[model samples]
Target: MMTNPTKMERRRALQDSLNDRINFIKSVEEIFNCHMVNFITGNLWDKHIPEPIKEEVAQLGEEKVLELIYHFGSCNSKLEVKMELTAPCPTLSKYLIACRQYYYDMTDPSINDEESIRSEILNDSSTSVSDADDNIKKRNLSSQYLTPAKKRHEVDVMSSFIAKMYEKKLANQGIIGAIVDIGGGKGYLGSALALRYGLRVLGIDVASDVTDAAKSRNDKICRKLSEKCSFYQQKTVFVTPNTDLGNLVKEFQFLWGSVTRVALVGLHTCGNLGASNIELFAATKTTDVPVTILCNVGCCYNLLDEKYLPEGVIDKAHYCLPPLLHGHSVDLPLDETSGFPMSDFLCQRQFWLGRNARNLASQSVERVMSQKKVAVDALFHRAVLQTVLLDYAENCSDTVQKKLLSKLDEMMVVGKGVGRVYKRNASLNLHEYLKTAFEKLDLDIQLPVEEVDKLSERYDCFKSKIKIFYLIRIFLAPVIESIILLDRLLYLLEKGINEAYLVRLFDPLISPRCFALVALK
Candidate 1:
């Protein structure tokens, strides 16, 4: 018999576990830093960002550039370091604040009452005399810029933050790529991303109404984007809507060539759409595309069965889920509609069990406790009770039955007082007996000995793998969303397109939102 752990022991264990995880994260950060520094020191920026953006990034001196890189690395590693090199700050939010201060110093001289602009620049420099002095200077700067100057500073900082990521690539070329938005309802997110990053977007969805809506929305966006880009060199925003993705992918590959990036921008692509994207990423090719990054925020995982795809393509091995085992011969099951093959006996068993549980609960609740009074709505318990009354009422304890009767007596009085004395044939003891039966039935059915043994063997082998996969699924929303992110990351890895200088505009931790995928390359 194992004893439960003490609170202090559990706490200590948790702390130690956290320390280990943090150390692992630190190692990853160091490895990434070493690789990025070696890569970035070369002409990585030259190949990636624009010349003007490069000049702006160059404005930050060597030490300052390293500081920015370090900050970026920390951010990438999910660390909360905010103070500049001049100060070892404690707070995480302070970093954003410091960046805002850096921008304020750049744009608004009125607020920063330094003796000279040169002095202010020097104070903002990495070579600032002391942390105390820098803090004092920053305080003075903050005191001066109270209103409109502060707003301008914020925008400048944000733009600069975004610009740094694209500094190397944006300078060299206009976006020489296409972004395919899967199930992009009105194509707002994709359209916005394209407009922001200077990429052409193609929104794909099965619904013609949504496609038509996206077309209308894109037309308006084009007019606005055209006006915005008119001052700069010409860049067009094209929106292709209402294309049936079932067969159009091959046609698109033939026409515009394969897009470099595919974005599933949360228009709620359900079951089949996700499975299709996985297939597309594995197969689709384009002339311009070296490899493609897929960014999806998917919903409705339950729907992505064998029926969601074209007939005769999906391999037996590339199952959306794993297959099952049997006594005789393991055979693949065909879908109800498609008559296509799928093999997942375990999954079917699980689904059946869930359905049975719900049905049994409903039926059981209806029986012993006639819908007479409003009391404890213990549906599950009631189901068990009905099962017991039919099967195992003889084994029930008299003490348990008496305990239930007491509640029934009180309910009867209350029911009469409320002008609704609905009487039923079943007594409180019977209800309690039924509840006991239900509990017993659950234990009997849910963890059958053979199933438990099979599960145990699998668990012993793949416990860690199972934990990681479950964590990824549980902590993240809809399966499609995780799939989309993983697809993009895999695409990046496969294409050798690793030097992604990207900024997460939406803070994931704070807002519980995901950042949009913007590929500068």
Candidate 2:
């Protein structure tokens, strides 16, 4: 699309901003993408991001810094107006805030509201999972929803939206089939749709054990809803582009007769699953599967396959997971056809999001801030350990080094590379942490006390240097997410699917990966 910078600049509705998405991305790609490596690699203060940018972010009021990252997205209306760009900011911080300004409010009060959706449906529609059933009324949902209110809220909102969309689709197209929960982990959202909306749902996940677990959980929900309304079923399927679409639909119809339409949905389809779902929905128009709607919330941008660089060409030594997996998709060969930059718009430019940047995109500012303090310098701690390991490999005897460095390339890439995530445990001291880290790695070699002491001394200054830079990265987290979601939205629009929308379906506080890509045909 829409290429006008001035028009894209003015805050507009999500619908209006759809036109300029690719152009805005173009404007910021050079601005933000350059730092993808530095964020992942250690020594960001000196290596990648300019020193001035770090200084500005560190020096600013915490409120201002917090405002830059969290305020401009879909869920909150805390800010009355966009922060002024009149005052100069370091080029990175300024554009990061500005990029967020374009995000369509998730609670966007548009015609797509629930009342409007109800209006589109036929009057006197009667089928339902008895809303007043005492069994359901009496049982506590804490077990099904788990501990948090977030999952409950997400289920309540998403079920209502999916029910509305299905009813609307039924009225407009006369298509009536079950909602196929693609990559439906645990099946809570899909199960709730069936139990609450009286809609049939089939949740497909990858593992048989997961399928078994989903049914085990569904049994808990079904017990409350009464046996008659037990409409949710979980099946295992690795959903690729070439998956048996007609067969899946047949299975849906076979189980429940009079099935003519299917709505594809997912609550949190991680990484490639999310991208692949979009591709499947777009391609299903002419297929035997009479699909009318697609709703998905994608997370784990880090796991999403990036087309810009092939996996082979990229250095594995710069990666974190080897013995442990990054995700299920990594087991499969990298397919440029499946992951990020799905739309041709960015594909033409060969837009690149290095693995580290994509990994950084997965961070939730809300989750991190909830801990009171920045929690732990998990990144800082990991960075220092990686340096020690690298130094050990280089300086130690060949035999000792080989013992420590087995599959080192496949090991966690820490220095001038990336690291694994850790929980905030502020009480940890460097020596204690090193003792525990060595145990986990199972390294028998002894490290010098002097080296450990030197690193301990460096921790204070290193964390300070890295602190502001990390926040800035956290600030850009959603902006990176924006680019990914926008590309998918643009893909739908380009296919001439006019009814699609990027709905901010869940509360960000509870469900951090809250944006759901919803499209109706």
Candidate 3:
């Protein structure tokens, strides 16, 4: 990963980086393009995986496959990656190595090397006494502000990276005095920047309630560190393509603030927020507070819009969502187009990764091993539940029937929504999963033992097979993520932002969405 985005010919860099990845993606395109819920929930004993990879998994069995998974864990202290496991399952093993090797130049956390997540310059000796003081003070933030230890690790990295850039921005242009923190939550990033770097910050959140909460939190923090903390403010606005950020904050007050120059930044921005920030950065030609730079870290690949999955495509994901969220994915607006394929290169290639694939891309083999649980059960539940949903559709009214699959016709129907019935991180017992899910779907309380048994039989002999099937999908996670992130970098490059760059900004185990996209004008 290029930590110092100071010097580089970005155009050639992006082109060179993109070429092989394009080839890699083309070769493995079918793996990610399939509807995974449909595929994984199918007969893993027979289909749902490539024959070569399937044979490889069958030969290696479950324990070896799991050991290989443990080799990828990083960023979490509790999880130690087993160094250099033998390549027993050649097909999947090679895929894992290739994925990690591909990551080497980006984040440097390959399976052969376990300590790559430790930053080279993280504890760099600073001549600035204030910098040293601030670093020491930051250690107390987790205890003081109720931030998680893992979260503090993320904040430290981002703070260091952004502060270095901000200093250069100040020394050269001397214009940017504040950052526009997009998708900021309760001004955490703002607090860090202001506390350590003496930078002014304006935290903008899409949620009004959060913005209000931020004000209260900021007031408390400000009073505690009144002398050191100069300025941090919060605002609530749904920043859109048409949003004029300069004008939005023009009337806003700042104690130690200037609108002459500003940077648009977001840390682990969920879904479209990251995309929207980048778009805002590009679109803004503001006279009020000129956004001279941008830095964004995006998560939730599944939350991203699918370019081809039309706006009206039934959001079969959220069954119990309120009426306000009925027509959309969540609180955010859905566009017919997506934030993906941002570069002309990818757009021209007609590249597409469906919802299941995107969700799969969000999976971390590292986290999977660290936690020691494959979402095999959750996925199993969802898949078997898909059949129930299909069966239930037969009883619904004509209007309701039109929205779902009429039969178990596996032509193109997506398995959606039943996962919504269960808690995201809950380890579900099969009985509980059935009871709760059945009740949620308005099915009979009496357990459908026979139907469930028939479905269970499809996967009973293939638990190892199912785990291995998931391993490969999880292995492909970072590769596809790298492609998506690189696409964003390429997008900036195509836009002629020569200073545009990507960095491995967070520890992958602590925070899976570690790559950040940055640019300066």
Each model's TM-score? 0.31, 0.76, 0.77
Q: Candidate 1 overall Cα lDDT vs. reference?
A: 0.32
Candidate number achieving the greatest TM-score relative to the actual structure: 3
lDDT of 3 by residue, 1-521 (tens): 53433223444555566677667756765555554445433444354466776676667767876777556533232323334454566666566666665655553221111122122222343222124233323423433574787777777778767776666665346564577898888777877777666667789987999998877886787677554444677788778867877775565544553467677889889876777777777774647667777889998887777554444433233232223322323222456647776778777766666565677678776677667777677766665665455555656666555444322222233433454756766677666787898676544545566766776787466555556656666667777787778777767767766556566666677888877787778
* Runs with alpha carbons beyond 4 Å of true place in candidate 3: 1-13, 34-41, 72-88, 107-143, 171-176, 224-230, 241-254, 257-259, 284-289, 306-337, 387-416, 420-429, 448-458
Rank by TM-score, highest first. 3, 2, 1
Q: All models: lDDT?
A: 0.32, 0.61, 0.63
Candidate 2 structure quality by residue, lDDT tens digits, 1-521: 43322222222343344445446555534333433223333455666555566556556754565554443333243433453631335465455545555443333334123222223332322323122132222223343454367777677777766776776666346766778898777777877777666778888988999888888887966666555434787778888766655467676565576677778888878878898888888874455657768888888887776777655434132433233323312222455555878777678777766665676578786565454346335656666776666666667787876665653534533222223334353456666667667777777656577767888686556665555556555655666677788778767766766566666656677788887888877
Using lDDT as the measure, name the better of candidate 1 and candidate 3.
Answer: 3
Q: Candidate 2, which segments miss by more than 4 Å at Cα?
A: 1-42, 54-93, 102-148, 171-175, 242-247, 252-255, 284-289, 310-337, 369-372, 402-408, 412-426, 448-451
Top lDDT hit: 3
